[model samples]
Target: MNFVEELRWRGMLHDIMPGTEEELNKHMTSGYIGFDPTADSLHVGHLTQIMTLIHFQRAGHKPVALVGGATGMVGDPSGKSAERNLLSEDVLNHNVKCLEDQLKKFLDFNSGPNSAEMVNNYDWFKNFTFLDFIRDVGKHLTVNYMMAKDSVKKRLEGETGMSFTEFSYQLVQGYDFYYLWKEKNCQVQMGGSDQWGNIVTGTELIRRKAAGNAFAITTQLIKKADGTKFGKTESGAVWLDPAKTSPYKFYQFWLNTTDSDAKSWIRIFTLKSQAEIEELEKEHDLAPHLRILQKALAEEITVRTHSFDALQTALKTSDFLFGNGSLEFLNSLSKEDVLEVFEGLPQFTISKDEFSAGINATDLLAEKTTVFPSKGEARKMISGGGVSINKEKIADPALILNTENLINGKFLVAQKGKKNYFLIMAE
Candidate 1:
C-alpha cells in the first residue's frame, strides 16, 4: 500500500512536500506525527492524523507518535487567535501519559521491523537550557522567516497579539523534528493542514542544521458539510475517553451524522476499502431513511475507539431508548451504565420511604415527580396508553408502584410517549 496514495484516495491529503512520496516509496522510512497534549483525551479532530499514521504503518514504514509534552507547555499558536493558558508540569505529565496510553490502542507496537513507537519531546528538551536552544537552534531561522509563517502572521495581525512563548513554538517543534531525524532516522513528519507552516519549519531545520533531507505530509482538517465544527456537539467535544464521553454517547455522535457528512467521513475515518465503501454507499442509497452509512461508520469507529463490548452496550442502549429493547438489557447494566444511558433525559427524585410505601401511578408522575404536570394529565395519558413504567404500559391510572417497580433497585424508567423518557430515582 502506498501511504500517500492511501491518504489521497481518502481525501485526507492536504499538502505534501515534494519528493515525500518518492521517499516513502523508495524504502520503509520512519515517519511521525506530533500530538499536543492540550487535553487528556484525543477528540475526533485528531483522528485524521491518527488515520494517516495507521496508513503509514500499513504501508510498511515505522510510525512514531510524538506526544508534545514540551511544546504543549509553550502552546502552539497555530490556528489560535490568542495565547493559551499553560498547563503545569504535573498536569502536562499526566496528559502525556494518558495520550500515550490512548495511542497504544490504535497502533501495533509489537510488530517486528516497522513497529509503532511513542516518544515524548520533553525527554530531549527538559535538560536543554534556553541559552542552548537559542544559540544552537534559534540562529538557523531568521526573525523575518519566522514572522512570514501564516500562524505567526495571523497572530501578529490579531488584536491580542502572540506571545514570545507561542512564537517560539515552531522552533521547539522544529527541533523535535531535527532531533528525531538525527537520532531515530525518522524521515517524515505528518499533521493537519494547519501545521503546514510548522512542519516545513522542521524540514527546513533538518536541511540547515544537519544538511539532511526530511519530508512533510499533512492531512485535511475535518469539517462538517454544514460548515459547523466537526467533533463537537451540544455537550462539547466528543472524546475518545469513555469516562469523559460515555461509549453510548460517543457511538451516538457518529450515528447521528448528517448524510452528506457521513458520506465523506466514512472514507476518512474508517479502514473500509474503496470497494466495501462503494457497496455500503449503494446500500445506503437504497434506503436513506435506515441510515446504513452512518451506522457502518459509527459501529466501526466506536468499536475501534472503545471495544466490541462497548459497541454492543451502546447498541443495546439505543435499542432500549429508541426501539423495542427489553427490560433484561436495562437490568443487566451497572448503576453507572444505567445513568449513562439516561444522560441528557429528564430526571426526578422521590424519597425511598415514599417509593417503598407504594404510590399511585398518577401521584408518582404528578405530585412526587414532574413526569406529568398534574394528576389529571397523568391519568389521561395513562388511560390513553401513552404512559409506560419500566417498559410496560400503565393500564390503570391508580396502579400502585412500589419497590417491585424500581429497576436495578433504585430507579423507574418512565416513558411519556414513544420518544420522551424520564428517570425517576429513589433517594
Candidate 2:
C-alpha cells in the first residue's frame, strides 16, 4: 500500500493536503512532526506523532523530528485551561537532549538519503531578536486570523483569558516550520488535529515570505472509547522514562486496556501489518476475554520502546506473580528484577541477623511490616487462611521466618487473598 493507504488502514490519517499522495509517489519527500520538550520523557500521548514519523520513514521518506525547545518554553494552549509556567533555558536544553535520545530508538538515523534527522527550533529562534521576528515572520498573519483558531477562541472565551506569550505560540511554531522548510528543504509538517491553525500558519508564512509551497498533515488526537483522554491512568501519565515508570508497569498499562480501546490502539501503535491485525481481530471475536489485541499491542510497543529482554522478563514476572508460575519462579529472579516488579508492593525492612536468627510470623506480619499493622489482625487473618507466604498458606501464629522460608534467601512474598501483595526484604 502507499503511504496514505497504509495510514488509512492503520486509522492514522486525519487530514492530508490536496496533493500529498501524488507528491509522495513522485520521489522521496521530507516530512517532520514537532514534539514538545515539556518533560524529560515523552508519554504515551506523544506516540501518535511518533508513529506518524515511523510510517513516513517506513515509506521511504525522510523524517525530521523537530524538538520544540523554544515553543515548549511558552507551552501550547491546545486543550489546556490556563496560562503555562515558562521553563528555564537550562531545563529546556536538558529536556531536548533526553527527547532526542528516545526518538533514536524508533527512527533509523543510519540509513542512506532518507535517514531521519533531529532539529531544535531553539537553534534558529535563540538569536532572532524581537524586532526582527516582528518585521520578518509575524507580519504575515493578522490578529483576527490568529483569534479565529479553536485554541485561541476557547482561551478568549474562558475565564483565564489568554497571555500574549501563549497567543504568540503558534507564530513561534510557524517560524519553526518556515526555518525547516527554507533551510532543510523540508516539505511537509505533521501534528495532531488541534495543530491545524499553527501548521497552516506555517504554510501561509511560506507563501507570503518565501513564495514557497509547503504542505501540512494532522492526525486525529487519540481518545479512549470510554471517553477519557488517551495516555493517562489514574496515577498520571505513562512516561517513557524508566526512572519515572518501570518497564513492567508500562507493560501492564497496555496489557490492562479494555477490549474496545485495544482494538483501535493496535492499529495506531503497532507496526503489525493489516493481515496480522485482522487475524488478531478474529481471534478476539472467538474469545474476547483472552485479550490477544492488548497483549500484542503491549508487547510490540514495550519491546520497541524498551527492550526485548524487558518484555521477556515482564512476561516471566507477570506469570510468576499472577499466573501459574510457582514459588520457585520468584526465587529465581535477580535482586533488581524482584525489586522493580514489586516496587509498589508493601515492604517491610528488617536486619538480616533478625530474620536469619529468628522472626515470629505474627510479629513479622504485624510489628515488622505494614501488611497487618497489628499482631491480633495478623493472627486472625492467618487463622482464617487468608494470609499466604511464598504462595503457601501461613496458619501458625508462632511460625518463624528464616532463610529456609525465604525466596532467593533474601525476600518473602506475602499475599492477602487474591490481589494484595507485599514484599518483606532482609537488610
Candidate 3:
C-alpha cells in the first residue's frame, strides 16, 4: 500500500516535508516518532503516531520508536496549562521500560531488515554536560525562532505562563533527531500535528550541525466530532496497561464510538485496507444498527493491541451484560469473570452482620449500603419500583437482605435506576 497517499486520503497526514515521498521511493529509509515516557502505559493519544510508524514499516521502510526519556523529565511546555514537576530517575527509567513494552505490540521489532528499533534519548543525553549542550545542539535555534511555535505560543498565553525548562524542550528534542541522523542515518520524524514545531526544529538542527537531510511528517490530531479531545474516558485516559484501564473497559471504549467517528476511525486505527473499510462502511450504511464499522474497528484494535483471547473474553462479557443474555446467565459467570466485566462500575462493601441483621431494603440501600446518602431517598426509589437486585425489579421497602439474594454467597448487585449500578461486597 502507498503509505503517504493512504494517510493523505484518510485525513491522517497533517503535514509532510518536501520530497518525502521521493525519499521513501529511493531506498529503505528510517523514520522516527518520539513517545513521552511520562506515564507507565501509553494512551490512545499515543496510538495515532504509533500506527503511523506501523504503516511506514508496512511500506518497506524502517521505523524507530524514540522513547522521550530525557525530554519527559523536564516536561514539554508546548501543550500544558501548568509547569510539571520533574520525575525522579527511578520513575523515568521505569516509565521508559513500560512504554517500550507497549510500542513493541504495534510494530515488528524482529521482522525483515527494516525491523523496528527502540532507542532511549537518555542513553545519549545522560552524561552530556550543560555547557556542551548549549554550545553544540542548543546554538542552532535562536529564542525568536523557538518562541514562534504554536505550542510555546499557547503556553505563553496562559496566566501561569511557561517555564525556561519547557521553553528549551524543542531544542532538546531536536538533538534526538541530530543524534539519530549522525549515528543511525535516520531521516524522517513523525508525530501528532502538535509536534510540527519541534520536528521542524530537528530538521533545522540537522541542517546547521550535521549538514544532513531529514524530513518531517505529522498525522491529524485525533479529535472527537463534538470538538472534545479524543483518547480520554470519564475515568481518565484509556491506558494500554490493564492495571490502569481494564481490557473489558478498553473494548467497550471502541465499541462505543459514534456513527460519524467510526467512519474515519475504522481506517486510521485498524489494519483494514481501503477496500475492506469501504465495504464495512457500505455495510454499516446498509444497517447502521449492527455498526459494522465499529465492530471492525473494535475487533482489529482489540486483537492487535490486546489479543484474540482478550477480545473474545471482553466480547463474551459484553454480550452477557448488554445482549440477549439474561440475569441468570450473568449469575452463571465465575466471580472473577463478573468482577472483570463490571470492574468500571462503582463498588462498596458491607459486613455480614449488617446485611443479616433483618435490615430492610431501604436501610440496606442507605445506611447498610452506600448507594444513596439517605434512607428517605432509598425508600422513595424502592417504593417507585426503580430499584433492583441482581437485575430483578424491587417495589417493597420491607424486603429483607440475606444470603438468598447475594451472588457468590456474599455480594449483592444493586441498581438505583436503569443506569446506576452499585456492587456491595459483604465480608
Model number with the top lDDT: 1
TM-scores of all predicted structures: 0.98, 0.96, 0.91
lDDT of 1 by residue, 1-427 (tens): 5888899988999999999999989999999999999899898898888888888999999999999999999999999988899999999999999999999999999999999999999999999999999999999999998999999999999899988999999999999999999999999999999999999999999999889999999888999998999998998998999989999999999999999999999999899999999999999999999999999999999988999999999999999999999999988988888889998889888888998899999998899889888889999999999999998898799999999899888899999999999998898
For model 3, what is the error of residue 210's alpha carbon versus the real structure, in angstroms, after optimal superposition? 1.9
Clashes (N, CA, C under 3 Å) per candidate = 0, 0, 0
TM-score of 1: 0.98
Greater-TM-score candidate between 1 and 3: 1
- After superposition, which runs of candidate 3 have C-alpha atoms over 4 Å from their true positions? 326-337, 354-362, 370-387, 393-398
- For candidate 3, the per-residue lDDT at 56 reads 94
Where is model 2 more than 4 Å wrong at Cα? 327-334
Task: Return the lDDT, model 1, position 317.
Answer: 93
Root-mean-square deviation (CA) per prediction: 1.2, 1.6, 2.6
Model 2 poorest ten-residue lDDT run: 324-333
Q: Cα miss at 53, model 3 (Å)? A: 1.2
Candidate 1: lDDT of 76?
A: 93
